[model samples]
Target chain A: MNGLNGIGVKVVHVGGNGNAHAVLREIEARLQLLVEKGEEGSIDLSGLPLMPEDYDLLEETLGEGEVVAEVHSLGPTRIHETGIPGVWWVTHYNSDDEVLAEFIEVAWCPEILLTPEDDVKDGLEALRARLFELNPKSPLGGAPSLDL
Target chain B: MRDETLLDTLKRRGISRRGFLKFCATTASMLALPPAMAAEVAAALGKVRRPAVIWLSFQECTGCTESLTRAHSPSIESLIFDAISLDYHHTLQAASGHAAEEAREHSMKQDWGNYLLLVDGSIPLKDDGVYSTIAGISNLQMLKDAAAGAAAIVSVGTCAAYGGLPHANPNPTGAVSVSEIIKDKPIINVPGCPPIPAVLTGVLAHYLTFGAIPDLDDLGRPKAFFGESIHDRCYRRPFYDQGKFAKTFDDEGARNGWCLFELGCKGPTTHNACATTKWNGGTSWPVQSGHGCLGCSEPDFWDGGSFYKALSTPISPVTGAAAAAVAIGAAAGVAIGLANRQTKAAAKAAHQKATIADLEK
Candidate 1:
């Protein structure tokens, strides 16, 4: 986040230090529940009415990880994997570039990244056509060679 | 030549004597049998003749058959499946046309009243069973005809047990459960969208061991498997007890893997072994995979209102009346307690002391 901050986005710590700590503590409790029971949940930051700076501070508190997924379908949605596995920081930006939504998602990964069964079923015909192309006897593809 | 026994079949299938014994031990434990009973079960199962089974499909999606075939690999459940003399199954049976019907007739006649009838689907009674037909014979007619010669029946899916999805709302087909149709024979309901495979084999094992239907609930489902609700055995139940629920699918609560009760989980009302036995070999269940239960095992689940509706939310007029009844009962309890207190106090006031002087007089 600090490296990306150099690209013109202003950075500052949130005004509500106590609030950030409390929310972090709440999240910590939820994480503990997950570790104990394998139970997961999402905490809506918008409901918390967290300031933009608060979101930044929360991310800083969570620290960073190696993997992140960017989704542009609904809006500019970015999911940042926290240091802890199964914990994620999801943020959404509006058309005007203002933060419209935020959530601390606790799961293996964000559900939005996964392809649904119905969608896959809808694409089956096209996928099957590709399958035909990869077939050995088909004109689009060739047979396997004797030497491996 | 003598008919091959279960032990013979297992050995033929390359399962060692030790492996076979281990399965018997596991089965004994799963069925809650005594530790010493494992040896008995092993001996009984080994020497027992393969019992004939006839599987009939009707108004079903063939999901039950799929669940059975796809149970955990190299498991004894599958071995029992292979060991059983499945004489006729519409889905899995290779024979077709009149040949298949002939095979079914032959088995029924040969086995007489000894073959186990494993039925998976509702018997449609509407329009003389015109909604569904096989080989020009109605499902109702076939069921009645087959049930006559069956020792016992195992209703394999929710459809056969409780007139599942097909019986939901309007119920155009006039679908009925196996119990509703055939009352004389002992019937065991293994209700689920598709019940866990081990549970299916578990019933088979019980039959093989004891030569009778397992102890059943009022609904005729085996008490061993259908004894508990999905909610009771669910891993997510702690969150439910804590009142933490996912209001939306993609919410923080959901991502955090809270209870799905708020998202319309039917686990509380639904009775099945999905939470414990699980699907895909105990890897995950509907709740664990982030979805609320559809309550597929229970009677008329589809008609119980929207699948996404929360349990706490009133789904019908009965819910409101029930809540009001609770309030009235509580008020009555308080009124009765007050009256009792007054009566006790009056009795205390009315009490007369019997003195030693009075006694002497």
Candidate 2:
């Protein structure tokens, strides 16, 4: 589940061991500081024990927005944009559907969501070749009629 | 009137200035004031005259008194009480009969129209208030008499504040709170079966510092302590929002420290500092000890049925859908199969035959 992006290098832990609101209080405090500083940061959740309930909290707290994109490398890595701009919910999993990593990335756009430049070059060539196939031969190259 | 200031007394008793400041800091935080106010509290408290406090008991158990008197590590609280000229407290005073009566009268006359009058139990007006008497004076009569010249009255327990157990169902004593009778005075309700030690003390500290009653809620309860419901401040609240609950005590959920909302925890409605301040001096409160809140702080809580019953079934719908969820779980899988070609192409472009040196990298 996507979590609320938190503050500067600070991991507000929502532990299952009865620290029910430690994270909520930390979030409240960080929100107060964010207003003063006019910047944001991500919540590091690598520490502490987590559970399904914790995932529900992440979903409820971060809040989902439109624009979901899935990437596949080792496994499916889904990226979701949250209601807040510059906030992203990223979850990477292995082929077995076992979660590898999950994080709330805070930025203009998470690096994982964008295609790398070298890969884009290949995409350009593939699109040109598709145009060549669409029209076996054309006086002015069929790419001129391409909507993209 | 004794002119020796609190600072003077504490210094004589070997309590350093730092010790007094630390106590003031704890007092400030407990009262929900900014930490910086501690110094101001210390400065104001150190200069003030040992204000006279007259404590009266009526129809109730002595649990409230026990909470304060039996407080562990009573040094700081004791010193503060010592700093105050507690002219009369029935349970703590060494005087008997006429002497106790005379001391009350004396303190009343000395600090007339200024002394703090603390009432701990509900006053019964039944049978011409003959049910409970102190010094042969009816509770109603004694209450009216004592309230006459007091600066303000503090209803120190649920009984004195909201006619606690004595006014519960059947209402045998026809008991009433101090506010029901004394309508003119400003009353501070520190209502709890037995209020937290620092809460009442915090109210006293506020009064001692500001010379006025702190902000109060509608029920005459102090806003600082009773401002938020126990559920909001509870440590197991995440479990509630996550729809996880412990159905019965000692179940797996209970052992996992899940929310006890299903176990009739009245924490959602009850307002008190027990969760934050904790009993046994920060050791644990009722919820921390593995039980739902009994809502003891609320008015007429004794009438609230069976403490083990859940507040409401907040998780029945989730449990009802578990079977359906298991069936549809496969169909709800992510549609990522078709998108794998681009990833495969990218991997093929990046792949290199493994060499022994690549393993190290």
Candidate 3:
């Protein structure tokens, strides 16, 4: 019990616009209750008890590149339901730094998984076969159109 | 001799053809070239006649020469000088006095605008270049004379590149690099205390095969060797990023092989491939062997700072020990009280033992 310090991860968010104080306050209130109950170790913001409107409040305050959240995983807490094995909480904010965009990317992990040599060959073959069935100059003939 | 192949020359010198090929492979790897390039290097080297090279030594300790000749792996003398037609070297040439000078003169004249110039030290430019003399001529005049008809120049050590030890603070003789004086010819700087022998041979091989100097950086150094900073390729860089530093030589940190960032290692700022290429065939670099890099290759690295101080941290105590002692005693009274009691009992026992011995005498 002497060194039961929780591990907290600080994430510096960049990009997006708006004030972050209100979103921060709401997160603090929710986290404070969890801390009091000794359940503050691993938080699932994706499963947060708060309303979707409240989550929207957070989204509204965030600008791109802003630090929208900090995750704190209490030493003893276990997060069984969220599928992630670790216990952590995220505190969010908004900022304007650019390098974090790679980390912020929506399709980052999927891109990493699909960009390997075998995957690239599979993709190229699919594209090549699709080309025979379509008109060369038509926008939607070879592949899905940009609008869709 | 004129028509001898490189393999035949090596065999004549008792170095096996396979061993000579291994040397070429080692050279290609050292230059960071692909493995496929090794056979091309060997083939190219075998066909060409040895290019004429003239060695010159100026204001130096001849450590470069010592390092070059002492290279036991490939033996710099055999791989470098013998591979090339070293027509005139002051230390190695048989001729003496005016005759030696005359040989150097003849080589430059006969191979005019074709011979390669290898300078081992800096040229003193102050006081009409009277500081360093060779054959009754200042280094400046000799440099001007040699560089006049040379095809290319390779400044062989730190002295020839950044004006080594002689150019430290209060450099009285105004020791300047070869480029500072000889600006006409294409110069390639190979800077180190005594640069790695493989790097030296690699550059020479590149020049021989291509018939022109290799790609150079802004400093006139080859990009293949000097492209990245030492920190970028250092094995201990992960430890540095994690902020795990060795504070002392014999401490637990040092024993764990932690990053030497706290020990004034200039690997972060200095650019060289020593961390990867290493000395004596990838055995170890200075930081790997427990000593920090002193940034020996950079200009004015000798006077930068102490080798053991952290590059960014504060070394001295923020507050005095007396103040810390009082504060610690006040804050942790029980711990201090127990320590003081143990000290007093130990001192009292020693004192009483001394007094009893005096009384008995």
Candidate 4:
């Protein structure tokens, strides 16, 4: 690919009607640990909105890359059980670190007063800093940091 | 009248002097020659006596003529009548039946070993050349006879250049290219479904000015225009290089104006001036209009697979894990994510607009 950094990343989106609840539950259920869900004001989940408020938010809230939106799959078999509509949000993070770490705080929820546009311009940048701290080797995984 | 200059013959035939000059200039520019060369063109074309052009139509439609006549930029009239002496053309000639045959013969005899052989279609050797005929004479016989005394042969279409559509799959006519028949004479293959009129005129202008054919490719096509593939000049090639492709006509990729390779574009394999020269007064080529290249200028393009399939090898990561790894870490991952999202949103918006309009109605 042209101008590629050669570092591949996957945007894994996990969503449901109550994404915060679901993510919290998954972390708890899988690792058997409790997470102090941050207060609504302290956390910025505007970039992860489940619904479209504007063109920018709508763009960020849907698709497999960085954001994901839930839509009916309409697959051939077992359509009823797996066909239910759900919220989806995508984020580019190292999967190996995510798989290795026992617990971590992530703010991908669009609801809880988070808009696509946030008051903190560098809030995502700080969140990235915290994410890297939790797993020191996350950024050193030989993946090209194609971050613009 | 017999001793009239070429310009005087054109004037007697009702072609304007200004039209003749315009044709000369356009020819010069098309050939990428210096503007000063136009004077050389006008001088050479003005002094020569009526040069004989024996045009043989073989196994193909008259699209080449239609395109030729529709050359309003320089105007085909200026090229055919003002520039050279078009002695025999089946479509344009007034005489028919025995008189038409006689006209070709008389012109051949009149300008022996000097006339130009302009072939617009391919010849079928199958069943004794029964695929196409004129006045009870096979195209093969007429072409051979016309070519016998001709100085050079100009194959004007893909049919004549590379056995175009008639030579496609299960070809019942056993169509053969003009190169196969007239090997001795200098053959210039202008291979397009109907090549750009400017290209045709350019070749003629170069020949008329220099008294020799321009440099030709291995395929006998003039190297000036057919040297580069359409893909090399396509504006959308950036999108292809970035790994962006329009998956379907109505998809987000299409709405985002992504690469059309996934949709079967033959731009990579097909060489032509369409990308640079453009069509209909240099407005846009087919890809700009949301259609992929069908590779019309290449040999046997008609028999090629679906027009939307990309001609080159796939360049994306081979394995899913590899693709996912690249997708997850690289900023390209962000771009890929953004591209997918943007495409989807655009599609959704279009769908919404259509639905709302329908509901309003």
Model 4 lDDT tens row, B172-260: 89998999888799999998988887678667766765667889988898888888888876766767898988999878877666778
- Candidate 4 falls in which docking quality class? incorrect
Candidate 3 residue-wise lDDT, A1-148, digit = tens? 1121243533322222222344355445645655466332221231111222444545444323312232111111111111111112222111211010001112112111223454466666667557736666655455543321
User: Which residue pairs collide in model 2, if any?
Assistant: B264-B309, B264-B310
Residue B359 displacement in candidate 3 (angstroms): 99
**Lowest-scoring 10 consecutive residues by lDDT in candidate 4 chain B?**
B72-81
Q: Against the true structure, what is every candidate's RMSD?
A: 18.0, 33.9, 24.0, 34.4
Interface CA RMSD, all predictions: 22.3, 21.0, 25.3, 29.5
Which TM-score value belongs to model 1? 0.61
Model 2 spans > 4 angstroms off: A1-148, B313-361
The fnat of each candidate, in order, is 0.00, 0.00, 0.00, 0.00
Error of 2 at B285 (Å): 0.7
At residue B310, give the lDDT of candidate 4.
Answer: 62
The list of candidate 4 runs beyond 4 A from truth reads A1-148, B1-25, B34-50, B74-80, B313-361
TM-score of chain B of each: 0.83, 0.83, 0.79, 0.77
State the weakest 10-residue window (summed lDDT) of model 1 chain B. B16-25
Model 2 Cα lDDT, one tens digit per residue, A56-81: 66567767888798876544667788
The lDDT for every candidate, in the order shown, is 0.76, 0.74, 0.64, 0.64
